[model samples]
Each structure stands twice: as structure tokens, then as C-alpha cells.
Target: MMNRNFNRRKKFIFFLPVAVLIVAVLGYVVMFLWNWILPEVAHAGKLNYWQALGLLVLCRLLFGNFNKGGGHNGFRERARGMRAKWDSMNEEERAKFKEEYKRRCGGWGHHRNKE
Candidate 1:
């Protein structure tokens, strides 16, 4: 256990600098792009390095995931669960479910012309 902890600490120490460097590079890229393009095209003010870095962090928090193995896994899992439930449903149950869904959601955007 001691050895394992030491190894983990060593790895973290080694990778921390790399991670920081990568984030710094990304921040510089963001700063460069915003300074080069947005000031001219969007009439936006130029961002300094720190502001660009903060913006990068803000965007990540708002719209990005920090997961290492990121993908649509959550959506896929939900879809898989729904598929399993649908497969297990009988025809009558499925029809009833569809009717309930249609009743709740007003069908699939098709409009009926009432004469």
C-alpha cells in the first residue's frame, strides 16, 4: 500500500507539469485567435493572456466535460435502457405507451386540419 501510494504520487507529480503546460498552450492559442480575429470581425475587444485563460476555463465549465473518457456515453446508456424496456414490453403495452406519449406530447409535429 505504501509503495502504491508513492507510485501514485510520483505519477501525479510528473503529470501535473505536463497538464499545466498543455492548458497554458491552449490559453495562448485562445488569446491569439481572439486577438487576431474577433477584434476585426466581431468588433470585440482584445483579450489579454489571463482573460483568455479565464475565458477558456469558463467555457470548459459551461459547455465542456472534464471526463477522461468523454463521449455520449450517458445518452447511449439511457437509450440502451429505453431499448431494453421497449423490447420487454408486450404489443398491447407498447401501443398503450405510444398512445399515452402521443396524448402527452401531441404526436410528432403533424398538424391536423380541422374542417
Candidate 2:
């Protein structure tokens, strides 16, 4: 347990600086792009490094996922659950489901030509 804790601490110490560097680089990139592009095209004011970082945080809070695994695992898990449910359905149940889905959704390829 002590060794495991030491390893964890070492990994955290190593990764913390890398993570900070990455965030700092992203902030600089945001600042550069905003300063370079928006001033001429959008007549927007320039952002300092801290403002750029804040904007990044704001955008993330508004429209981004904060999941540690980058937010796709939840989708995969849901898809897996759906597939399992589908596989567990009997033929009659599956047919009924398909019919109901078609009725509700107007059927797939509803706009396609029959020919």
C-alpha cells in the first residue's frame, strides 16, 4: 500500500506540470487567435492571457463535457446497453418494436424513391 501510494504520488507530480503546461499553451493559442483574427474581422477587442484562459473556461462550462475520459465512454456504454436489450428481445417483440418505430418515425428512408 505504501508503494502504491508512492507510485500514485509520483505519477501525480509528473503529470501535474504537463497538464499545467498544456493548459497554458492552450490559453496562449486562444489569445493569439483572438488577437489575430477578431480584431480585424469582428472588431472585437484583444484578450490578455488570463482573459483568454477565462474565455476557455467559460466556453467549456457552457458547451463542453468535463468527463475525465473525454466524454465518449458514456455513449459507448449506452450503445452497449441498447445492443444488449436488442439481443434479448424475441423475434415477435423485435418486429413489434420495428413497426412501432416506423409508425412513429415515418419509416427509415421515407424520402427515397421506391425504384
Candidate 3:
């Protein structure tokens, strides 16, 4: 177990620099593209490498979710857990739960109100 853990750590350490280098290359690509296209097409200001990196981060913050279920307090994970619980329920319990939901709210299928 210790050897396995150490091997994993060694791999991570080895890959970390490569990952950073990839990200830096991508940032430079972004800078190049923005400078190449946007300034001429949109009359936008040119961006330096650092500005491009900042733009990458800003776009990630605004439009991306990379939390691996960390944000929202693991809401997706909790949803999966609830699904597992439902799957583990016996037939009677499942039927009873469905009936209770239909009673309190509305039913599925034909039970729905036409109006």
C-alpha cells in the first residue's frame, strides 16, 4: 500500500510540470489568436500573455464548472446518493413512496389533471 501510494505521488509530481507547461502553451495560443483575430475583426485591444491567462481564468470562472463535485456542497453527489437509496428500496417501499408523492402532489401519467 505504501509503495502504491508513493508511486502515485511520484507520477503526480512528474506530471505536474507537464500540465503547467500545457496550460502555459494554451495561454500563449489564446494570446496569439486574440491578437490575430479580435483586434482586426472587432476593433478590440490587443492582449499580452498574462492578460490572456487572466482572460482564460475569467472565462473559466464565469462559464465553466471544474469543481469535481466540490462546489454546491456536492449536490450532484448527494443526488447520486439519493438515487442509490431509491434503487435499494424494496418493491413495497418504492410503491408506498410513489403513492405518497402522488397523494401529496399530483400523480404521473393519466392521473395528471387535463385542465
Task: Indicate which candidate wins on lDDT.
Answer: 2
Better candidate by TM-score, 1 or 2: 1
- Runs with alpha carbons beyond 4 Å of true place in candidate 2: 66-73, 79-115
Cα lDDT for residue 56, model 3? 84
lDDT of 2 by residue, 1-115 (tens): 9999999999999999999998999999999999999999999999999999999899877766555756464788899999999999999999999977766767566853332
Give the Cα lDDT of each candidate.
0.87, 0.88, 0.87
Q: Which consecutive 10 residues in model 3 have the weakest lDDT in total?
A: 65-74
Candidates sorted on TM-score, descending = 1, 2, 3
Cα lDDT tens digits for candidate 1, 9-80: 999999999999989998999999999999999999999999999998788777666566454458877999
Worst 10 residues of 2 by lDDT: 106-115
After superposition, the stretches of candidate 3 with alpha carbons farther than 4 Å from their true spots are: 66-115
Winner by lDDT between candidate 3 and candidate 2: 2
Residue 91's C-alpha lDDT in candidate 1? 100
| Root-mean-square deviation per candidate | 4.1, 6.1, 7.4
Residue-pair clashes, model 2: 0
Greater-TM-score candidate between 1 and 3:
1
